[model samples]
Target: MRTLKQALLALLVLSSAVADLPTEMPIPEAFIGSPVGTASL
Candidate 1:
């Protein structure tokens, strides 16, 4: 459970970092199954 939480946090941080890097940034396989929402809250 702890590892999963850490992985989620890591993925979130990684995604934000990637999003800021550029539009052409590549996502690693570790982020493949992560959930994404179409609606912005």
Candidate 2:
């Protein structure tokens, strides 16, 4: 149970990081060519 809680917390932190990515940039056509946008597709 303790390990599960830790895993959940880690997931929350990682989700926040992913959420921050789009907010950090416009993600325009230029970004689409990058790995991040391509992976999203």
Best by TM-score: 1
Clashes of 2: 0
Enumerate clash totals for all models, in the order shown.
0, 0
**lDDT on C-alpha atoms for all candidate structures:** 0.53, 0.58
RMSDs, each prediction? 8.2, 7.6
Relative to the true structure, candidate 2 reaches a TM of 0.49
- Tens digit per residue, CA lDDT, model 1, 1-41: 99688667766776776676556544543244334311111
With a 3 Å backbone cut-off (N, CA, C), the pairs that clash in candidate 1 are none
Question: Candidate 2 overall Cα lDDT vs. reference?
Answer: 0.58
Q: Candidate 1: where are CA atoms >4 Å away?
A: 24-41
- Model 2 C-alpha lDDT per residue in residues 1-41, reported as the tens digit of each score: 99688667655655565666667565465346554446546
